[model samples]
Target: MSDFQSPLEAFLYWEANSPNQVFLKQPVNGKMETYTFAEAGNESRKIAKALQAFNLPERSHIALLSKNCAHWMMADIAIMMAGYVSIPIYPTLNQDSIQQILEHSDSKAIIIGKLDNYATQKSGVKDIHKICVGMYNENDGELWEDIIKSTQPLETITLPSQDQLHTIIYTSGTTGTPKGVMHTVGNFIRSASIMKQVMGLPHGSRFFSYLPLAHVAERMGIATHGFVIGAEFSFPESLDSFASDLENCQPHIFFAVPRIWTKFQEKILEKMPKKKLSFLLTVPVLNILIKKKLKQKLGLKEAKFIVSGAAPLSINLIYWYKKIGIEILQGYGMTEDCIISHFNLPNDNKIGTVGKKLSTVETKLSADGEILIKNNCLMTGYYKSPEITASVFTEAGYLKTGDIGEYDHDGYLTITGRVKDQFKTDKGKYISPSPIELNLSKNNNIEQICIVGTGIPQPIALITLSELGKAKAKDLLIQSLSASVKEVNSQLQKHEKIEKVIIMKEEWNVDNGLTTPTLKVKRNSIEKIHQPLYKSWFKMEDKVIFE
Candidate 1:
């Protein structure tokens, strides 16, 4: 393998060396559409030529709104080859967010691909050129297929310099409006190189790209890393076919957030009741058989590396997966750092921590306990927001991560909570809600939860029960949750103890604006929605307040 300076060079190298090797397998219209290295390279070049024909200025931003697809990757590569910065928008975002990102990034054109609802998304934009990737009936843009067939491929590919802007990824805002994080080609190369060295994935390793590619973590971990290591990438047809897709791909490396891991646990327990599965595992011979069979059934028997990130995972969930012969290593990083900060490695793994800092990264705790980092892969800054960008870094030049964390003796870092998420009570004592939430989430009955106590005497929990929990009698569900709440409260300080656990009447989700696209709880949004009930819930005599 030859050393490459940029991502385009890497793609070209694979295209020349392994022309016929399958690079992407995308399920389209109930059929698999495969793209070889040469095909993807050729298509991207054509797209680049079409983009150049538009005569946009150098380094103009091109926006892409789509779910995970092969066309999404092709568009991104084309944007880079045409000397333009790619700005990806989450497909699930509402019209307001879509309009905000488009205007903020100063995007000249947008490529619309697979989305849940395009009519609403398209109506929000006022002025911008639109290009349709697939079959869309709207009269807004030219079809990608038409451009590829008519336009000639670029005679020469303009590879970007290390310092040149590559993409502007908007953060998935859990608290407020999203910021456009600027990343250069050098940042991605450094991060991917470090990841390649750390994981040591063999050539032709299978990668299933189910997560939104717009997110930096998915882009770096699956798309960029796959290209760097010459891995085969596969995309699911749709959410309905996710299971079959996973089974078909049987990926060598798998990455998912905590919510997905929890869902997996629920699915397994649904098939085989926890008590029965526990009993079978107690027998020596049955234990081995059951573990192997279960992993195979879940299509993770071939996975060499399993990672969970985006949000804090419960320690008990990790232990539960370990019992089934799958060890999930939790990683911690943000968009500003190219999502390559800390990760747990095999064998040297710490159960509850996000693991030690990566070899290429430097980290230290701030005076106020915030995690500060200085690394080669850090983003250039927030696009067009120099003041805001400057505020995020410390005087010592380290990125002042809003998250508060601590390191153990061996240098394993445990995320205690987020500084922004901490709240004060009427008693004037501050509380971090994440640790308490993690403890309560260990209860199999709890699906999702948020702890809030701002301006109140004692903290309160708003919880959404799991399917199993909801199937049981209401009294039984409350009893189980009460026991779990008491157990968690026993470990907390007096001011931090939860006063009540209120069962939420409606499910919180992305469509409902209660959760982010990545499934992180939108604490501010949830609080606002339930603000009216706070006083009434506080006055309730029962410890578990069920609606």
Candidate 2:
């Protein structure tokens, strides 16, 4: 396995060793459809032959548009085993965004999953081959099954160099357009292996993957290491079914973004109040009892790790989970770096810090405090945009993370803010909105909150309340939310405190341009659209409580 030339090669070797092991599962028609490594490998071979039948040059680009389904993994390895590059798009993308990515990547063919919104996408884009999941609508392009059946299994194909591009992950540009970040196989495999070493991802590690696989986080968190290590991966049929799915999988290893972690905390605390539960744990004997109760509630009694990343996590939430015997660690990474840069090690947990640089990567902080990352995990460059790529790296060799980070005496790294998200209050105090926002939104009822007021006396919290919690927590909502925000406000300087709160009635979604498909807020745009009204809304009161 160590001698394998690339990640895909290692995966192929694992498949040969344990062909009958259950490698992947997908929900079809609300029922689980399973696949063994051998079955999946054979299906991928069919797909490779199908791709080769196009008569295109070797390593032709193929795009995968789907949610976290077993087929998405199948299509990816198929592309790799066939010596083609895979460009994946989130299944939630709008038709226009999908077209832009497919067109931008010059994908020769697009494999799509069954999504209601994308039913019309087959004929919408130009110059790209289209195939649908499950069945053929005559108006839609060819059925996915039909294409695989048309070709015999590929016998031989030369794999690309380790440094060759494997995927182009497109991310939102600060300017509202998107840029494709290109990564090579070495970058991906090495990053994935770092997680394996940091966490105890020995063979047969159990993992449940529900995040949008198009994100680099999932690409490395599940698809990359999960593939090479032959982990048991279970997919949630849909977001609504995620809890049921998690209960069923009860994976030993858990990795989730801050938003999802927040949701998990929210869901748990909704049934059991965190503060009351914490008070009950004041006694040593009761603490263990409460911890057991919490574990049973989370269905994670056996889960060894619950790591949070893809954004800043609130320290209060981390400490709260710790009180219940759950170790919630933070990770720091970006698409440009193939998703892993820093991880809070198990024995080395610091509440506010993201963690130390992975053993496989080296990091340095510039005099100005910008993080400089250099690793095999660093991407080749932004696809077709050398100017931007060149700007992100040092001529001497380091990827400028654009994150303002600092290291404690213990070597753990804490991210203060994005260099881009730093804002100055009218009082001239510089404030980073992310940490404050994370602290304030610990209330399970507030789904998302963006801190605005770059040029004002203090920040204002524009909150998108969690509709899921509305019906159940109706009477207790306001007091609960105010208490949570106040607790977070205690940690902030007087100038950095939120002067007011605005609870939004509507959800800020990707389709609305408020959030990226990955759920990170488009802060600049949100501020631009809402900042002007701050004086009228915030200055009039200290707290705008929704009655």
Candidate 3:
């Protein structure tokens, strides 16, 4: 059970108990700005007063548009304090997407802060009431600091009922249009309680909040959990200062996506060649010293829990980090579940799997092998879409996770692939690309891979080269990739074997509309773009073909 009834109650508890303690540490133009619990509460109350002064209806939906920053959390608190529902939008979303979510969620007002490009996105807000943060130089609406300085504090705090609407987190739209996932105050409380208990989080733990707070993983893991334990949050100034800021904060609990982990590995390998690093790790004293240096460099030396999520990370990459004394605990969850499905604890970690189910989570497999989940923290439903929401759950009321998986004898679950990601070749056999993609990604040269066949004779691997691969000569890259294809093919069935490896000239990214903000590849987009070329690519004489 949670110590407090709601997130606001937890925040109030911390404010009363640890008023003078630092709650948020944000880096601005190389300078660190901190807000104590008392100070944050004061600002939040002032913002709440400003919102109330607008005369919005009770329980009106208010949207939060910002990158992960101190003000984003404050704005969320302000929304809750004003007795309104919060709707968070991904900062990386295009203008149309921003408009879609705001209109779909029926948000009355929006609090914008710490955005990279507000000029292009400001049009999406249209005539909605916007409270912009001046700290980031946003001028499209009423200034945040100006209101805080001018408005009086809201004295009356409104506590939400257990089942009252809390927030609507819109999906990243990798599949289609973004759908708002409606969560209640009780969901946040239960999720926070589970995270605090499962991780043994301390009151004063330092949290580095770099991931998009709009994302459920970051929102629950950092913001909600921080309020529960009075944790100190540190935000990077920008991408350029992320390394320095993280190093300075030395956060106790750190979470990053698989792409970020890969980037860190690439950065380390840039300075130290893979072969040399492997050789040095064999020496006892040097290995310990090197691991310590690596931890310090990655700003994880003080981290108690380091986790990777959002997508499947290669087991080889996990082992690579293990060699350097960092054990990445890979977990599994979705937006609908509030990310409380499964996690690998530090002591009970199962390397290849996404760990066992959380204490309160019940998991089972469907007839088709899809993972089904039921937990106290699950979202009530997708906002404004009853039919769509009803379709995603089983008749037994479990959330159909859409991902196929298997449970080992020890109850550890390994995700094989998504049910929708399976495709059939012209030969009539359906193939799951995720496992093949995972195996092929073990080659350090391959950065991203999407196995496609659809209506072709056999599946072909479409890939973008990694930094290491890009730096190598063309012949060397071909030789290396060919060997990988041959090796991976040796383990697969004849019908499921990849016929060719096609190296694409362009990389799939958020900007290209080929990847989600969390960096998960849009398999549908991949098929749409390259399905016609699959047969031709498969007919190529060479084992590896550069596009």
Per candidate, the number of residue pairs that clash is 0, 0, 0
Compose the digit string of candidate 1's lDDT tens values, residues 378-481: 88899999999999998878998899999999999999999999989889999999999999999988888999987789999999988887888988888898
lDDT for 467 in candidate 1 is 85
Q: What would the TM-scores of all predictions be?
A: 0.98, 0.91, 0.98
lDDT of 2 by residue, 1-547 (tens): 5645567886787788989989887765578889898888888888777777677776778998877878888888888987888888877777788888888888898777646466555444567666666631233466768766775777785666888888899875444678888888877777777767677667777788877888888888778878767787888887677787787787887787667767777677677676787688898889888788777666577788777887787777788778779898888888888867887777877888988887767889998899999877788888888898899999768999888989988899988778888888788888888788877766767788888776678888888777555665655666677677788788888988877778776678777778887778888778878777877775575475441
Error at 107, model 3, angstroms = 0.9
- Better model by TM-score: candidate 1 vs candidate 2: 1
Q: By TM-score, who's the top model here?
A: 3
Which candidate, 1 or 3, has the higher lDDT?
3
- By TM-score, the better pick of 2 and 3 is 3
10 residues in a row with least lDDT, candidate 1: 133-142
Full candidate order by lDDT, most accurate first: 3, 1, 2
388-440 in candidate 3: lDDT tens per residue? 99999988889999899999999999999999889899999999999999999
lDDT of each: 0.88, 0.78, 0.90
2 against 3, candidate with superior lDDT: 3
